[model samples]
Target: MSRNILRHWFSVLVATLAALAISSNAFANTKNYTVTAPDGVALSVQESGNPLGQPVVLIHGLLGSRLNWDAQVGSAELQRYRIITYDLRGHGLSGKPTEAEAYRDGRRWADDLAAVIEASHASRPVLVGWSLGGAVISNYLAAYGDSQIAAAVYVDGVIELKGDQIVAHSEVYRDMISSDLKTHLDGERTFLSLCFHTQPDRPTIERLLANAAMASWDMQSAVQSMTVAASEGLSKIRVPVLLLYGEHDALVNTSGAIARAKQLDPQIQIKLYANSGHAPFMEESERFNRDLAAFIETAVIH
Candidate 1:
């Protein structure tokens, strides 16, 4: 070909490449970082979506990592909100302190969450907690109060662990605190199964089991032993609260918990996933995302 013809083709190719680069950057927008807790433990954090949008920090359940919120993080419905998800200490890529005392005291949980919020540069962001994460956020309220967050969404979580409520609600709680590894692992599997009304696929089950095995058993037991009752904090919260639970949740008393939460905070809104179990976020993601957006718009941003 002539020099002129070759140059024209090269220019077109360069323009195409530039467009592809811009598209790739837009598609891969998530950023990962680490936040060091007050106890000197580093927590892995992931932030995605529009940086200037409203922030929503998500905390995972027991043995669950930031990966649990992958659906929400990547959903187009939530693209307008800055989504932040982190691995709790002793789970996933976060630091694991072998000492039982680390988990026994609830300060670390609150501090870790606070560090994440500060790292995200988010003020009064909505905090979404799943399962044990409910306890973690409750602990945060107990320590830091509700000034830092605009609202809270509890996804089949434990808001009250006082008295015999937890023990009576689920046998898995007892197994989690048990000393026998076999019993604990068995309980973990059972708990995972109960999280969904239908059983998860083989790969998902294996992945969940692997994540559960990565947790420090001692730390799990230690945290489970600690008493976390958020009744007072819930009553005192100035921001609106949203509670989401599955109708067939075997691990927690969904109806009872919602009733108790409503009694404690009249501003609380509760939603039940008719076809789901413990993990309504994953099992019924579309509805969950829609409800979440509605809640944020009406109860929080507006």
Candidate 2:
């Protein structure tokens, strides 16, 4: 979808449209920080907005880094909220244990995120996830309960996957990663390019490649465990849930995830970006930041 089309769909944590979407004359200030999750994963996080603003924890999906939220963290509207975006254990500068067990479970990733929130010293921050990040958030809620989470949002996320497709998808990724791991670096860049149709921001994509190699080689185990966690635990999440899907996302279908999440928690909110797909924040920065800020403004974040 065209960038103009995406603007009407999803939003970002940043206060203004990204430099790619709008003139550099208007933009939000961005900063970077790193924190350790409870499970010992040292996650790299990018933060923006007011120091005294309401806290919002952002999570990126599979093979994605916290840098994916660069636009969100740099938007003027997003300055209203304390935005937190980070790479999962195996995706960014985060510490990745070499053992298979450490890389195999979403619970560990959840612990890492929980630690980030507590480390920030925020009382209760709203949690937001995109794509596989949704699954991690779901698992975090299921594993830790919602005492620290005031609300949550999903941008083109999948709450559940049919058993067969899950297997098929896993197989494809397994083969892809395995074949690419020989050079390791080459594979990560290839994977990133596959994730986005547009050539990504140069420095950001290069940083992603650098971090991917920092991840443990036991990625297959991580993917499998996370898949199972999302499939089995979707019905148990209790916090206020929001599902935002891009209209044309092939990664996570709107109807399927909505129906599944509804079956699990009827209170879940589902919104569709009329002209967006998997990466709505990048595709539609302005409208997304506006709508997202408005939606978050409605939340009584303590």
* lDDT by candidate, in order shown: 0.83, 0.67
| TM-score of each prediction | 0.86, 0.78
Best by lDDT: 1
Per-residue lDDT tens digits of candidate 1, residues 1-302?
99999999999999878655543543498788899999999899988877888889999998889878866876767777888889999999999998887887777788899999998799789999999899888888888889878999999988776542342535776787578888888988877777888666788789889888888787777886655658657878888888998898877877678878788888788888899988988888878989998888875754
Q: Model 2: per-residue lDDT, tens digit, 1-302?
A: 99966775556524334533432322335566788766666777766667688888888877667767767776767766788777787776777676766765667866777788877886678888887778777777767777777778878765765642221344445554574656455555555554443445788677657655555566644565554355445566555667777676655656777777777778777777776767777667677778678767766542
Roughly what TM-score does model 2 have, to 2 decimal places? 0.78
> In candidate 2, which residue ranges exceed 4 Å CA deviation?
1-33, 164-171, 179-216, 227-239
Error of 2 at 182 (Å): 6.9
